[model samples]
Target: MSASAKKQSIYEPDQEGLYFPRPPVFSTVAEERQHRRERLAAVCRIFARYKFEYGFAGHVTVRDPEHPGLFWTNPFGMSMSRVKASDMILVDHVGKVVEGTWAVNQAGFVLHSAIHEENPDIIASCHAHTVNGMAWAALGRPLDPITQTACGFFGHQAVITEEAGAVVVERGAGFAVAKAFGDSKVAIHQNHGLFSVGRHSIDEAAWWFIALERACEIQLKAEATGSPLKLVAPEKAAHSAKHLATPFMGWLHFQPIYDWIIRTDPDLVD
Candidate 1:
């Protein structure tokens, strides 16, 4: 290949007739709503696969395309492993279950509702009590740029100290969390666990949550060794984050997981 062809292949491989999968576009709100619901269901199953479950304490939500005030979330009391698209519940900002027969989790409603309400740009949000995430959050500090994977959250992560470890069931508590979130994509609620958001798709939110949990685990394990850890330089970490931590990248990285989920647990969409 010519030099120009090689450069184009590297930078714009999907420019023309390439087979890269892109986020789907829908013609109608109904079609888009169904897509989001299925994706949310898949994310829940993905969380289950990653063992991010803790007696239904976790929640992943995707905003309704037509009705921005509402979102779809896993039913309260349902295991992430068993949640299906049809079992997902539609909830309004006021904590009302507008659709679906199953009840909504109050803690989930308080936090996710405030997040979706306060941030119009956020299309999806995920929060879970994973073992590593909880352990890291207990330290009440943000992850250091110790690895390239950790670099993804170098400047994009926040640590919310207010209401630390408190159960987020009150409206005011939820609002506090959202206020701390501001524009960051990931947050570690002090003494709680991980939270992530997506401005683009549920795939992005889900993937970021998974990535954040893994990063937390890696950092914890590294620190446990007691040797001084080498930190990535600020400039380099920022550059790495710019390219690797984008919403598009998160969505792209999730495609394989989505594919695997559909193939192995096809009933999630039911």
Candidate 2:
């Protein structure tokens, strides 16, 4: 189909600005939890497929709708490839496991809990120790708006070197990380990895992290050639970032990915 024809078929062409149908809106916390769980499980599979899994040294979370003080996360020591919606655990701010049979990772809880607590507007957060993310983060720099995808991070990312390599067992370390993030949705934790926030849903958080990883890979390769990098114009980059790099867009982009995962591995919904 032609581009204009595809747009004509969208549910709300001017409103949503894409070919996707309207997503299922939830009416209750129970419905929201089920939705979040499905997305979280699919996120793990996507992470694993892209080699974002790193010996259980990562986490992603969404605040529990019914229990605001608690959030859901992957089980400690579980392989991202094996994680399922049923295996995710709910944990309180103090790192105590509130539900499920798995234990919580103190560092995961510490880092993510601080962000969730400090930024009430954020709904989800993602973290992982990926190769490109670590390489770019080691330079303690934010992503340059070198490509269209990179612009999603134009002014929406930061670098955090505070307490590098420090285990986040204490709430203080987590708070420091949160403070470093400030108003941005992403942070390059020097010598650690990347962390991205979702203002609305797990889909947004997961997609941003995935895109950030690829963007970092692109930036690293471009820097290695010793050639001066050509970046997008600042004004244009900012404009695109605002319009194309939205929470709803993030959610929309992940729909096909979730569909494919469900088709190949239906157990993720369990």
Candidate 3:
């Protein structure tokens, strides 16, 4: 065989390796579900790309805007790197699987359901155990803006200092998490990890992304200075949050980034 032919054979995709490309837009319920599946896959893929997802654990959820009682999440025990839109399962507020083939993970029942049920404005949620996020969570402290990157979380962070042991098993634990977040967009589950709420998948993903990166940066800078860290005043933080919470900013900032990811890896939509 020619050298070029051999090279072509080596580079060609196998039958099972081929993937379908995502459509440019979605216009129906099926298309929307496909979009949600793709969005969930993108969340998982981004986590894996940034090493943000917890192994065999952690979760991200999106509320069905039309069906308030149902949402999509990663199937139990799936690796964040390999999660597909087809792998996502739909579960009701009571934790029963409504649409997908897999069962709801325990943490999904305990953490996401309550957030979705209580907060009508919250359309998507992301939970993860990135090193910096875990460090702050372990310290049992709320995140503080030590840099401009942390500005996104300025006043929207809540510290859930007391998470009941085995929240998934305990009754009302989900509701408790909802209460802690209240109207805030972020929650730090002490000794556990971080949770973010958004008006859409991109919104929540951006919150988690900024919060985790900020936590990591703060910890690194604090260690270098070996001195007490200063935090922006609450009022200032609140003011910044007001601007960050506006839809225009989030869409402008995040949609382009998310669109880039979709364009580069359109198969995630499948």
Candidate 4:
């Protein structure tokens, strides 16, 4: 064997791309389901790595590929850092745990189920109690596009003021939050935290939530300095948002984070 060949890893991209190559194609729904399970577990670890965990306050869900109406989510009360593919619970629309031993979190059930039920286009949802998101939600206003990161949500984000500072444990409250997501991918639940949805994959949903939180923190920090915030022009912010806010864009951005988690927390896939 050539020296170069020995130096290369066993894996290789099927095709080349400027960003990442096209992900592998799955011939059966079974393969895709496992892929999503791994992705879900990876998302948990990624958020944990970034200190997004707040005593199991965060939850993410992806529609089951085999059963479109059902979804897979991290088990209730599980620490975010310790969530594994084996710990994922498969729940139906009615909040019943059809698979896994762990009970589902009522908050995850109420909030995620409503969004997944209302939006057929949305296949995944992410919600978390990030400090910055909660801080911004306290303001009870939409995010101003003061930076490129914030612009990623210029026209695709909204604020939910109904259940301010309250946990949404009822189906009605959950439905109300879902309604606030009208035509938007991100929602800052007033005095709560953040909620983001992805059309195709939870990768996008998770990445968008992380991005939105960081943007909120940046905005808050920038404002606290007592300096005038230089807001982006509406047209420019819209254009930038259009370019950065797509589901695929978020999924692509998550690839490295996914890989990082896989390396650092290999047990997440157990």
Candidate 5:
């Protein structure tokens, strides 16, 4: 490849006229909805691969392209590892499973529904009770920009305190979370866990959740050493976040993981 080809943006075609990976464009709403469902199912499998499951205390959702008020999520009681496109349930904002044989998780519906309802621009959301995320949440604080990875969330994350540890089955609790999540990519609920949203795709939401969990783990380990961890400068951290925390970058980062899951667990498309 020529130097100019190497300098070209990854989103552009190479000198050989080979195109880089990009989000698929669908010609119809049905095709987009199906694509979202398949991606959502793959995200659950990816979460399971990271061992993010804890007795069904997790959910990821993608808004339906045809029905904006209804979203698709894994059925209640289904293992994240076993969720497939067909196993996903379509749920309305009122907590009803409008389509699908399986029931929905009330907590998941309450939280995710409120988010989708309140933020119509958000295309996807994810929440899970991962060990590291919960551990860091116990501190009731936002992550410090101590590393390049953590810097992605520098200005784009919030620490939600209202009803933080409460089971989010109540509409009010859900609304509280939605209010706190204003324009942020991720929120840390005090004494609870991580919640991430994506304005582009399920891939973005899922990848951010995974990245936030790792950030939590890193911070927890660093603070556990009782040493003063050096923090990234505010200006540099902001610049890093601008480039690293974009919705497109989040989606791009998950493509390899999505490919691996679909290739190894082909049944997820069923």
Candidate 6:
């Protein structure tokens, strides 16, 4: 079908925009849409606050509960700090664009779609190229859980030694990433970057990244000191993870950082 015909069939075209007149309008329902908008905005703001975003690169995806095969993801070419709910695109499980105008990042779909497809428990996925996270990714050694903060990923870190280009472009890349993850929550894509999966929001991944980064930084500093590195016991690490981790704590830690993003660049909300 022609572009104009397709638009005419599904929506009323106007200067204001294509309108879905039959879509339900609700007072409280609008509040939910606004909440989704703010949550997406919060993700962008947090990325900006930590400088985790690299221009239009990297993205976060959240699954639509009603549509198991569909998800909401940041639009391609949009800065993480500038993302809005209206800017998110709904994509099918195979990475096909189902709604919204912007394109989806192929790399993001390569990694996120299979994870979402295979792991029903994972409601969200966040991928990034932060300085420390990327640095750790390049290291031959994985991030050692030396501190309490790092214990969140105590037993969940996996290293992917496969060529980065291979995973990004190949059809089996998603399966490769999923294999590397195994039963883990975090995967260290050696020489690439960090990826974290969780129940919802980018908040969990953000916390994991920050904690892992700090752990790596401390390990480096301790190495330079020429002192024997103190390590947490395996049992203790497990205990801490079970007792300390919650979606609430994840949001708490990143909200202040996001506040910084909001204050410094309020235009990000636009």
Collision count for each candidate, in order = 0, 0, 0, 0, 0, 0
Q: Which lDDT tens digits does candidate 5 get at residues 119-167? A: 9999999998899999999999999999988999999999999887888
Query: What are the Cα lDDT values of the candidates?
Result: 0.89, 0.86, 0.69, 0.86, 0.90, 0.68
Two-way TM-score contest, 2 vs 6, winner: 2
TM-score of model 6 (CA atoms):
0.77
Which residue window of length 10 is worst by lDDT in model 6? 2-11
Q: What's the TM for model 4?
A: 0.91
Model 4: per-residue Cα lDDT over 1-270, one tens digit each: 333442122233334342433355799999999989989998888888888888868889999998999999999898888889988999998799999999898866898999988887898998888889889989989889998999999999988887778877898888888887898989988888899999978888988998999999999999999999999999999998877887767877788888778888898877
List the candidates' TM-scores in order: 0.94, 0.92, 0.80, 0.91, 0.94, 0.77
Off by over 4 Å in 2: 1-19
Total backbone collisions, model 5? 0
1-270: candidate 6 lDDT, tens digit per residue = 334543312223444554333212346744644444555567766777678888766877777656667778888888776676677888987778998899998876878887787787776777877777777777756766677777767777777776553447554777667666776667778877877776655566566566666666676777779988777888998987664455545545666676666677666556
Residue runs of model 4 more than 4 Å from their true location after superposition: 1-19
- TM-score of candidate 2 versus the correct structure, residues matched by position: 0.92
Find the number of clashing residue pairs for candidate 1. Answer: 0
Specify the poorest-scoring 10-residue window by lDDT in model 1: 1-10
lDDT of 4: 0.86
Which parts of model 5 are misplaced by more than 4 Å? 1-16
Residues 159-210, model 3: lDDT tens digits: 8865633455553777877888887777778887777777755444554555
Give the per-residue Cα lDDT of candidate 2 at 270.
Answer: 81
